[model samples]
Target: MVSFKKLTIRDILFRSRMAYYNRPSLAFVGQEPVTYADMAVIVRNVSGMLNTLGIGKGDKVALIGENSPNWGMAYLAITSMGAVVVPILPDFSGHEMESIINHSEAKVVFVSAKLYGQLDRKNIPGVIAYILINNLQPFDESVTTPTAGMPYETPKAIVNVDYCDCELPRPDEDDLAAIIYTSGTTGRPKGVMLTHKNLVSNVLSTLMIQEVNENDRLLSILPLSHTYECTIGFLIPMATGASVYYLDKPPTPAVLIPAMQAVKPTMLLSVPLVIEKIYKNKIKPELTSSSLKRKLYSFTPTRKLLHRIAAKKLHKTFGGELHFFGIGGAKLSFEAERFLNEGRFPYSIGYGMTETSPLLTGSSPKLVRFRTAGFSIPGQELKLLNPNPHTGEGEIIVRGANVMVGYYKDPELTQTMFIDGWLRTGDLGYIDSDGYVEIRGRSKNMILTASGENIYPEEIEDVINKHEFVLESLVYELRGKLVARVHLNKEALEKYYENLKHSAKDWQHNAEEHTRKVLDEIMNYVNAKVSKFSRLNHIVEQQEPFVKTPTQKIKRFLYKE
Candidate 1:
């Protein structure tokens, strides 16, 4: 739907300037929004500042910050000025951030106030300047003062610039726009090089899945540094002149609930963990709180009715204006998808990686099914390599305008990332006769049985996650046998032993026995659903949350026993 002379970030920005100059662009919830016209001015000032600091086209400028209006401004200023933007995840450790910054060879760094203390000046000595992203002010250590182990000083830190008449370059479609470093579950971080065509084409392709306009509102809870949120959640909406709201803090219930009510967003982007938590922690418990309710929820018609009621309340809790809810970055639990479809909730699923501009296949709410990842987007061609004759599963390879150039500065690995010119997706899945995609699991995480059967641990873990007391479960191979690690719901565990808690003085041993009993029940339930080779031999308590990426996918490298 987007008409442009060339597929470039500059085209997206200036088109919005001409077509919707007065429209709202970005804002935090309950705050004044920056208009498109205002964005053009701010972007120019920021670009002018970068030029003043001796950074220009082809140079990399790093942005380390939480989501805010200024964060978007910094991104546009860097990319539209023909410089590459290197966005660092705010959740990364100080060491990780330093390594990424130095690796990218950034000329200037824009850091948020909250993360300034974490910036170690000893290692990343390549940075020429540091500007505060909150107020666009250039500062040095001589201007800062430390107090009580905290860096605090009025020190004229906030600089408000009004305008800049500096000239900016028009980038070609092949020009590099961003160098995004992904801390994946595989091994180490890799810098992904995305061109203007790769991103602009992806933003437009994703719009075919779900359209937005100047009137639509989006609440962004995901990190802007991740390609999934940056391309679809931020860039696509901005290209269509939609309003996007950010949360000043983390998206805990206390912050997100109020912000949703205030914005009443028409569209939202999220990973499965957000909805899974609401379903398991909130709706699932209420529907099965009593024997009669559990019986009713088991029946077909009654369960549908109950689901509809719960879905309605859930919709209202999101301010009752949601029309499209996109879940991506990881595979959603099957139990949650069934609830959404049966309940008539407006939910969709997508599949992609940071290497593919983050969107290869996705579905609108109308086309979504129980487990399908839906159809490939426009301008993308998909094929299976060495598919199983029985299951039709294989490595999902793709050729598309949206695929990244390659891993930045890693030609050796990038050469291995493709097979006969088709980019290897590293995902194992099948394309059905109806052209729908179903992703099984990652290839690296696949387990091989002694008899040579392919075992996808995700399938068994899906069943484990449905248990009432299970919050999340991980499946791995331990010495040729499948073992599961489950994080229990403390509230659910307490409620299960309410009688023993009040009546028995010696409750610790009783609690352990009860937990062991539930684990056995869950193991039996999962083994019955899976193939014999895929059955879990043991289910152990994890006791802590799994380490994860910014997108909420578990970091499997740590638990690959």
Candidate 2:
């Protein structure tokens, strides 16, 4: 890891220019690259704009938008000028968005025009202004023009409103950097207050774990509003003088592939679902066209060749030097991880909840470990509380600088989260002798059988995830019987059945046969690998896919009876 013994966020940004001197720091779709020189100017412009608006030290501002260069600019502008930034997820529903705005008490809101309508001003307090990003609609006197430059001028009536050059306050490291709302799996969202020290320290610690340099170019697709991207993608890259690119539109294969190949990014931070979908839907069918290709893929010798081809193909997609491909936000299937590993692809598995500034553990290229999530990140503390001796598993507890200050303004709920100052991470997992952390499902998500056996649905789902035709699986007990609700891969199924000698009566018959075969294979494999208590009894197939979060994690509670 790079040493930042005396570095601050300001120092990190400025020092990188000295190191990488002439590199681009940011590139937006269809826009000119913002060089290190331009970065300084933009930051100052942001400071000037805030000063003009009477926003200063200790003020709270909310930035709500899709992942874009402007999003990063707004965040840095606010935090650098001694104000707290509240990053609202762009996909948040109208009610959730309103609740966060009211709770954060932000005096200014920077929102995308598409989502601006979702915010109701009734609950927001003293919001001096609303700045539209890329929208040209007329607003109140407080609506300001974008600092980078706007073709349209401020109306004469609002022209004299103050946009000043007041000095930016120099806040202490302990000052709040952001208040991020975590997508609660079982309850309403909580605003996790992360201080400047919390975010900067986490970025430094991550740099220590993974050695990224000034030349490293990163493709930023994860929501900047999320801690995962803010910490790893934005802050870390800026700290090291790496240029970050934001897509013009949503991240589909068509949009991402061109951006990736053009940028030839050195790094990519993403969820497992992205790669898993590509593998199951695109890669699997190509490899199983004939019995020989299928047999060859199953064999280690031939699998190595397949892996090389896959790595090369992926390399082409990412523009090479694709040294670090990180997967997080949810558990990945064994098959997907194995393919990447066997193909000699470099990737990392990270594990953390939003509360820890999200970097509790991760694996690097040199220290790759597939099954386990990896050792704790530098500087954080971890422990398991109330372990089950036999299984060596229990609730995961963490305490460190990276942990959020507290849930925003909800002292009662916040008090319950910290048991003797250690954050009660709802996850259940254990550490290995080598210090690696392997996470099981959530402690609250565990289902106990009538026979006095405790079973984890996520563990069974992980096993089922390995099947070729399965996209996602959710396991839960219904009427004393363990059942699995699964989503089949329609495209993969159609291709597989098309190759069959006998024509099926209908698509339903073909799907039933495929489902039965998959269930029998997965059941036999899991039953052999797991204890009888953990084995699933029956499987249910759905033509429709389960609704998922941005990270592709199935909202289990949404499908519950």
User: What TM-score does each of the candidates earn?
Assistant: 0.96, 0.90
Best by lDDT: 1
lDDT of 2 by residue, 269-334 (tens): 999888888877777667777889999988988887897798778877788778899888888787
Model 1 lDDT per residue over 1-561, tens place: 777788988888889989898999988888888888888777777777888788878899999988888888889988988999999999999998999999999989988878888888888899999988777667787877222233222122122353255566667899999999988987589999999999999988888777789889999999999999999988987899999999977899999999989999999999999999999999888998889999999998998899999999999999999999999989999878878888999998999999999899988898886798888898889989999999899999999889889988899999999988899998999998878899999998898888989988888888899988899989998987789999888787777767455444444657677678888988998899888788889998888999998888888888876
Task: Please identify model 1 stretches exceeding 4 Å from their true place.
Answer: 145-165, 499-505, 509-511
lDDT of residue 32 for candidate 2? 61
Q: Against the true structure, what is every candidate's RMSD? A: 2.7, 4.1
Give the Cα-based TM-score of candidate 1 against the true structure.
Answer: 0.96
